[model samples]
Target chain A: MLRDITIGQYFPGQSPIHKMDPRMKIIATLLYIVMLFVASHPLSLIVGIAMLVLMYRVSGIPMKMITKSLKPVVPIIIFTSVLNIFFVSGDPLFQFGFIEITRQGLMLAILMSVRILCLIAGSSLLTYTTSPIELTDAIEILLNPLKKVKVPVHELSMMMTIALRFIPTLIEETDKIMNAQKARGADMESGGLMQRAKALVPILVPLFVSSFRRADELAMAMECRCYRGGDGRTRMKQLHYSHRDWIALCIMLVSIAAVLLLNRILA
Target chain B: MAVIKTENLSHVYSEGTPFVKTAIDNISIEIEEGQMIGVIGHTGSGKSTLIQHFNGLLQPTSGKIYIDGEDMWADKSKLRDIRFKVGLVFQYPEYQLFEETCYKDIAFGPKNMGLDEGEIDRRVREAAAFVSLSEEQLMKSPFELSGGQKRRVAIAGVLAMKPKVLILDEPTAGLDPKGRDRILGQIKEYHQEEKNTVLIVSHSMEDVAKFAQKVLVMNRSKVFLYDSVENVFARAGELSQIGLAVPQITQVFMELKKRGYPVNSNVYTIEAAKKEMIRLLEKGGEVRA
Candidate 1:
């Protein structure tokens, strides 16, 4: 049942979005998130949503997957919208005991939810299009300037790549261990919260032990391969910005400017 | 009566997701009581997925699994009871060990069954003995033991539960030849002593050939063949077509038979091959260096 997590998952495709430079995708995602916040008016939000739909069409990623990514953040979305309803006071629309719902408050709540949803959807597109390894490489390259101050960019990226690679492995291991424990009559289900937490001791202890073992073995393997991080290292698949990437970056900047313009004109 | 039975059992992993895969498809099998069955398949042929269903570790996407004539999922609340009735030792089980000492690790299963302290202790020691774990070793942390010893402790943990049917998925995997033999020997002994159903999933044809009386060959998430060892090995050509082979010794015998030798191609184990050679020799067959 734990296998449902799709966070940080990439879907392989031959679409333009998938083939875009990871650095460009990351920057575009950040800009998209900024646009969501800048988009205050309903027309701006509509533009934002239309842009997302266009990107989804161009990327060839299923709409279902985009919505599925927003599932985990539903609670946060609700909490923020509820908070905005009570906190953002203006001309009252309705009133209850010690509580007032204003027209501005209601609009703020809707806009806030739209902003958060667009933020998540925009960020998730980056992950969906870029492989974890590519993302790590992009991060390392983007942070290369920090290396002048001895930031250990290569080591950080290597750690990230390794962690990403082991996630599925560790998840598979956990599933195996859980099944083994369950077969021995470990009552993981049908238990109180405390009992369930205690039941996890059997799973967590083994997972931790195996994770350490894997880390040790990985270090040894890296050493055997004569890996000396950052110094005189080269990549096989060099990151290069194509015409498509430049076009994508241009589109993102234009949309962000348009959102800001709409916010000024409408608000 | 069948101790465990499945009718049209099918399981689709990550259903409705992009990663949707039918792990096992419409599998139906009846495992009689006290039968020693070996399940053979290529990797990702749903061997692990199939055994996980026996203990209710996985619920089938469709169809039913019956344990002792009761539908396993009929009363979802009783699934835990079904697990105790059919124990499964997973591949690389040593990694599942987590207790402070080997004793506690072995006792984990019985304790989970909610057995009394005295019974749990007795079963733990008996299981330790069955796996030939020394008394001195039981007190030490499971982390302190060698890889093979850790595997034994893990197996003993399941054995401590004393399930009516025991299923092991690649139990001898990643062990040296001697260590592998020791484990297979102990499992054989356990099956004999307990006279309960034992199902072993293995890639090693020889290991399965040596222990299992009945063989179930799976290919592409479906049962390819289910028959006696001799009958299954006799169709080595069909098995090889599906990326599985008969035992190495059986292959040698089959090769000899093809070369016009009077040898039994159905012999799966070295001992059986030896007896066949002896019979040929007694019948005045010429011996060649």
Candidate 2:
């Protein structure tokens, strides 16, 4: 059940988005987020939505996956929307006993919900098209400036890479331990929160034990291969920008321009 | 009646995604009570998925599971009860430990079962004993134990619940020869004491040969073969065709038989192979005694 988590999970593909340089994709993602802040009017929102739809098409990542990634955040979106709608005092459109829906409040709710949804979808698109390793590579390059300030850029990236690499491995290990415990008749379901959580110990204990063992072995193996804190280390796959990256950059720039104009005109 | 059974069971990971996968297709099998069943398959052959469904860890995409002829999912509210009846000890189970002490960790499952304190203590002590863990060891944090000790504690955690039909997915994986034997030995002891339907999902033909009386071979998300150890191992070539090899000693014995040696080709365990070799030697074979 724990393995079903799809948040930030990459869907490998050979689409245009997948082929674009990770550094550029990373930058495009940030620029897109920056643009979203200024997209207040419905027209800019429509354009932003259109761009996301177009990007989704080009990326070939199935729409179902983006929807899957949003499952856990449903409550968060609802909570934010409710808070925005009820607490934001304005001219009431309808009044009932203790509840009232206001015009400005409704718009705020819609906008906040849409913004949260779009943010999640857009960020998910980055992971959906790019593998974790590629993202880490992009991050390491993007954060390379922090090295002079002793920010441990290499260590951070290496840690992120290792962590990302282990997600699936850990999930697989969890499956194994769960199976092992289930065979022993360890009840995990149909419990109160405490019971359910307690039931996880059978699964978690062995998982942690094996994970630490795997880490030890992995560290030894890395040391054997001369993995000394990533200092002076190089990658087998180098990141490079192509014409497609330029196109992506241009697309991001257009979105930014549209967001600015819409905010100016709407205001 | 089958102790555990699946009807047209299928599991599809990421069902509607581009990375969707049908890990286990419409596969069905019935496990009898008190049977030591060995599940052998190549990697990604749905061995893990198949075992997960035995208990309620996984629900089939489009099928039903009957635990002792009762629909496991029918009482969804009591799913943990089903989990208790059909225990599963997953692969690399040693990592699941997070409790402060080994005793608390082993008692974790029983506590979840809502057993009384005295009962939980009884189960915990029994489980620890079954896994050969000592009193002194139980007081220490599970994190402080050795790798094998931690693994035993993890297994004990589940065994403490006393599920009727136990399933272990590669219980002896990644261990050295001695550690492997010790783990396997404990599992055997557990099965003997519990007398539950034991299903071992493993790729180790050697362990299966020595431990399991019945073998179930899975290939391409299907049940390729299921029979007594002798019957299944006899069709070693079919297992090989599906990327699974029979026990090495059994393979060696078969090779000898194929070369016109007047030896029986049914040896699985080392002791059996040794006995068969001694028998052949007594019969005055031209080969060295």
Candidate 3:
């Protein structure tokens, strides 16, 4: 079950979005998130939703995967929408004994839910296209300017890369430790909150011990291969800005502009 | 009576994913009570998956696993009791040790059974003795122990549970020949004293041949052979096809047979090979003549 819970899972593809530079993808996702918050008008929201759908189509990720990613947020979406529907003050569309459903409340709730959906889908699109290695490479390059201020950008990205690489291995080790403890009759699934937290001690202690051991081994291995931090290090696969990346960034900028213009016009 | 029985058991890992794999496939077998059975297979041949099902650690994908004539998954809540009845020592079990002292670590299983303090202490001491861990050693941190000692402490933790069926995955892995023999000898002694069904999953043909009364050979997620040690080793050629081979002595006997010597190819252990050699020498010493 732990293995099934994919985090920022990548789905490989040969589409333009998949081939786009990770830096552009990261920037576009951030800009898209900002545009979602800025655009309150219904027309602008529609433009945002259309853009997300078009991007998904281009990325070629299955519709099922989009729904799968959204499944976990369904509860949050429902809770927020229900709260907005009841709390917003406006002309009452329906009234039932102190429970009033106003027109503005209904409209706001619908737009808010749609905006949340688009926000999740848009960001997930970036992770689904780019691999973790590429994402970290993009981050290091994007933060290269920060090196002038002694930010240790390369070290930070190296840490990120190592962290991401060890995530799956640690998860697997956790699973093995859990099963080993479970075989010893450690009840993990059922109990009070305190009892359950207590049950995690057996799993966590061994996991931490093994993680430290692995980290030590890895450090020694890197040293054996002449690794000395990120200084004077060269990458085997260099990041480059292709025509596709520029075109994608241009489209993202134009879409943000269109959303802003529509917001002002509708207002 | 069958202590562990599986009917059409199959386990699929990452099912419904693109990387789906059938770890074990349609394995139907029955193990009698009080038998020391050795499960041998190449890596990824499903030996570990099959043993996990015996203790109810893993639910079968499409078949039934019956422990002591009862369907293990028939009552979900009762699986805990089933786990106590079947102790599983996972591969590299030393890495699972986390307690402050070896005594506390060995007592972990019996403590989980809600036993009285006196009973837990007794079982812990008994288990420590079974693994030949000293009284002073029990007071030391398991982390401070040597690799082989830590492995024994982990094994003792499971032994303290005193399950009706004991399953160990690669129990002697990553140990010296003497350490390996000591551990397996202790396990054999434990089996003899308790008369409990024991399943040892290993890669070493010689170790299995030396201790196990029966051998369960797995190949490509299926049961290749489930027979006595002699019968299984008799088909060394088929075993090699699955990336497994008989013991070195058995291979030597097979080679002798190939070169027109009348030695038995079923010689799996050194003692058996020695006896065969003696018989060949007593037959008028043809090469000497």
- Choose the strongest candidate by DockQ: 1
Q: Write the per-residue lDDT of candidate 3 for residues A63-147, one digit (tens) a residue.
A: 7667877888899999999999999999999999999999899888888888888888888888888999999999999999999
Candidate 3: regions farther than 4 A off: A257-267, B287-289
lDDT of 1 by residue, A40-145 (tens): 7767898789888999999988899878999989999899889989988889988898799998888888898988888888788888889999999999999999
Error of 3 at B57 (Å): 1.5
Q: Of the pair 2 and 3, which is ahead by TM-score?
A: 3
- Model 2 agreement with the true structure over A38-115: per-residue lDDT tens digits: 788656777677877888989887777667777778999899888878878899988888888898888888877777
The candidate with the higher TM-score, 1 or 3, is 1
Tens-digit per-residue lDDT, B179-283, candidate 1: 999999999999999999999999999999899999999999999999998889888889889988888888888788888777768788889889998898887
- Any residue pairs clashing in model 3, and if so which? none
Lowest lDDT 10-residue stretch of candidate 3 chain B: B280-289
Query: Per-residue error at B161 for model 2, in Å?
Result: 3.8
Ten contiguous residues with the weakest lDDT in model 1 chain B? B280-289
- Cα lDDT for residue B28, model 3? 98
TM-score for chain A as predicted in candidate 2? 0.95
True contacts kept of each: 0.86, 0.62, 0.72
Give the CAPRI class of candidate 3. Answer: medium
Interface RMSD of 1: 0.9
> How would you class the docking of model 1?
high
Task: List candidate 2 segments past 4 Å from native.
Answer: A66-113, A146-151, A169-221, A228-231, A258-267, B98-104, B114-130, B133-144, B189-194, B285-289
lDDT at position B139, candidate 2: 96
